[model samples]
Target: MKQNVWLYIGEKIIMFVLSIFILSLIVFYMARLAPGDPLVSYYGDRAEKMSTEEKARTMERLGLDQPIYKQYGIWFKNALQGEFGLSYKYKEDVIQVINKRAENTIWLGGVSFLLIFLFALVLGSFCALRENTILDQIICKLGTISSCIPPFWMALLLILIFSVNLGFFPSSGAYDIGKANSFKSRVSHLILPLTVMVVSHVWYYAYMIRNKCLEEIRQDYILLAKAKGLYVHEIMWKYCLKNIMPTYISAMAISVPHILGGTYIIEMVFSYPGLGTLSFESAKYHDYNLLMILCLITGIIVISCNTLGQIINERIDPRIQVSEVSRYGK
Candidate 1:
């Protein structure tokens, strides 16, 4: 068992390394392929008028004169050593730029994730318990509609309703500029964006969980539990929930990274000072180093969460054979 666990972990580590390498290569190439020069973001209109010699000197300074493979090699080596290069646009270390914004993103994402799960759990379970009832049908329709609506559009509608019409909630910005340092002011500013995030995500998860619950509830084991005279709530909570946990964990793991990434749009809509906002600005200004770091961070988050979720699922359900999973993947 210990040997299998170690082998599973070793496989995951190998996969992680390979995924990072491939993702880093793609990020490097995509940044280069994108239109606009980093020098333009650095020096603005002056870049267009610079002489060939000046351009060459500037490129040399930024190491842009190096061959593409050489540049990637240097970047990969530096990244391995915890040295993400400087941000040309920010005039700061890549880490510093990311750190300044990461906390706000974490807070926003964390709150949104918690709300999504909590709400999904309650609504999903209730709908499943009341399956085929009017309430279940209503919730199902609502989930369908919510899934169809784009998140950005929902964000706009929320801003229009709550911030504009209702005279509540700030439409944009992390906090009022004058009271920016106050925790209360920041929390007030977060309400609209947080609501937008939660509303946009909750229904789909709820619907999915509801269906999973309904399916599990109809299983033979659940029927057997009911025959044994177990309480409905006990059967749902203990048997049904446990059986569907792998699915729940898998979904959460897959979705968390997306939630983190989705903050780019949400933060942009609200002008919140988070990783998403930072990412938008970085891409807009052609800040390759900053963008690269963001991509790397996102890749790590997704891969780490997925691996962790799989490990937890395997531990919880010993029936899941790592060797079988590996063979299936092959």
Candidate 2:
């Protein structure tokens, strides 16, 4: 039976609004708790030497003189209208500065995400097929080691090998912004960071996929197919894959947030130009606006991915989805 799309949309809208409210509250309190005062830093070392009248004037101009509730009301209003307010550190609109860096970060994340998906899907399937063979044994060991190493440690190791010792890749920074070069020049520079990021993402999901595939192979469907004279390859390529579809997509979707929020160490170690670097610098410099905005962005991305994964898994297996709705709706 057809359900009400409007009802679904209404529910989603409510959830979205509530999420924004919760995020704003958390960000506001977290910013307040963080060390240092934005005002003192904004005015410079001579902030204490400034007159009360001068200080009051500056606070009034920035709207910081208002009560906390009133300040949040104004900020929330503007934020809903797409005006994110000004940054004390950059002396520019917060959204504008963030957008500039967001483009590069999104691009890098997207490319790395694709590499991760492809690597995990192909190599994971191959490993599953070769289970109990030397190839599978080697892959399992390697994956375990790769997964065991922390992302930061891997990043430092890469830096030591590629940047510090060999000097093959630039240690930090994006590219020569002004230097004229072919399209290849920009892409080549991204290889090292992208490689490290992809490897980190790939192994986690690949192991999950391997385990999912193995479990799927034990299902009665596989036994039925095998008893029907199906080839082992055919059973794996078709039945086993179909069975593990949910697990694969779910695992991949879960990684989306990690990839988005992570890269801090990688960015810091490699000095890559991305949100990770921006967040680090903002926190170090006590740029409250930037720090809060980055946190908000990261939260939104993670929540969005989780919601997407739920929706997708439900759609792919409507029996479970419908059961869930029925259980909750009543």
Which residue pairs overlap in candidate 2's backbone? none
C-alpha lDDT of candidate 1 relative to the true structure: 0.85
Encode model 2's per-residue lDDT on 1-330: one tens digit a residue. Answer: 235556666677688768967997887766766777577657667778888898888889888788777777887788789877777777788788887777668667888888888888777778888889999999888987887777777877877898789988766666666642445655766777787888777887887777778888888988898899998888888888787887678867867878875566677767777788888877766676777788888877888788777777777787977786785573
Give the per-residue lDDT digits (tens) of candidate 1, residues 100-219: 888888888998998998898888988999999998899889887886788888888988998899978888877788885789988888898887788778888998898899999989
Q: What is the Å distance of residue 241 in model 1 from its true position?
A: 2.7
lDDT, residue 5, model 2: 56
- lDDT score of residue 27 within candidate 2: 78
- lDDT winner among the candidates? 1
Give each model's clash number: 0, 0
Indicate the TM-score of model 2. Answer: 0.88
- TM-score per prediction, in order, is 0.90, 0.88
RMSD of every prediction: 2.9, 2.7
Candidate 1: give the clashing pairs: none
